[model samples]
Target: MLRRVRRQVADTLRVGAMTLYYLARGQRQRGAVLAQMFEVGNRSVVFTVLTLGFLGAIITLQAGFQALRIIGDTSLVGPQSLPLLVRQLGPTLTGLMVATRVGTGIAAEVGSMVVTEQVDALRMNNAPPVDYLIKPRFVACLVMIPALTVVGIASAFVAGMFTAQAAFHTQPAVYARFDVVKLSDLAEGLSKAVAFGAVIPIIAGASGLMARGGSAGVGEATTRAVVYSSLAVIVLDFVLGGLAFLVFA
Candidate 1:
């Protein structure tokens, strides 16, 4: 058991070292990385925007109704509810969505490549597979996830505003309380995005790299990557949420 534990620890350290090394040297392949990032991030923009927009509309309408009943005035709902959606719910939901959507794709793609020996082909050509594969995805997801989060927040706000203004007849300025959205909230959202972005791709890509056996192994790795990455995002979200309260409270 001790020997097995030591081996596992050693393998983890080795993987960590390799991941760091590739990340450090990733800049050399900036063009490829940027291209991949654009493809991955941009491709997913439509879905992210649509999903967030719908969510925002739903939250706004529901919250507005509840607030109206409590205070006998609908306008109070706009101001009271926007902050909760933006500060608490928006970023967390956006990060998780991106993780599940794109992170799984990364893992499955890389895992398939490993199983098919495509990664070996790159290595045979003196191309480092990590540099060619992992770095671009890592950089892309990290950069794009935040952008996606921003889109989600904006969509949510716009949807909320539309629902409040059109459906409930709330005044425009009632929802325009920019003062409520503190810099601390923005920082927390950005921090969550960054942490999530860093985590998902690494977990997915690493799982793919570690895949053994044949097609079955690739499939298993792909599944594992998605599961592991999703769990990591959730755990990190909680940790960041707590930290956000401490830092911003």
Candidate 2:
């Protein structure tokens, strides 16, 4: 088990490094990157918005209810939740969504290619699969995840404001306070977004590259990609959040 884990980790790191090297050299196919951006960003916008919006509304309603019960006032609910939403909920939830949606798509696509020997054909032609397959997706994710995070944050904040206004009779001005947020908070959130984006493609692509067997292998790789990518996002959130607390506290 430990050996298997070690090998998977090694493969992931290797793929990540090669993808970064290609990206740094600007060796990616621009059209492929643009297509992936559309896939990662445009296709994901409505899902991200709807999911985060409902989550924000639910959270605000619960928080306001609790605050009203405890303190006879719900005015602070929005102010308090805003920082949490900006720094944690926005990026983390978006990362999870991407991990499930984009990660699975990447893995399935590459794994299918592997099972079909398409990757082997590329190798036969002396073409690096990492440069062609992973780099474009890596670039796209890096660009799009932060943008998605921002969209998610705005959606959630607006939803929370409306929920608070309707549920607790709180004014929009009070529910939309930004004074509690700081540069560090924004930095922390965006940092997590970028980090999650960087890992998703590399991990998913690595899983696909390691696929074996046949159709079953592709399925296994897709499942592994979703699980590993989601785990990476959660672990990164904890690590980055801790660092932010220690540094910015």
User: lDDT per prediction?
Assistant: 0.75, 0.91
List candidate 2 stretches off by more than 4 Å: 25-28
> Residue 52's C-alpha lDDT in candidate 2?
90
Report the lDDT tens digits of candidate 1 across residue range 61-99. Answer: 887778778876776665666666666677777766776
Best-performing candidate as measured by TM-score: 2
Candidate 1 Cα deviation (angstroms), residue 119: 1.2
Task: Write one digit per residue (lDDT tens) for candidate 2, span 14-37.
Answer: 999898787777453548989999
- Pairs that collide in candidate 1 are none
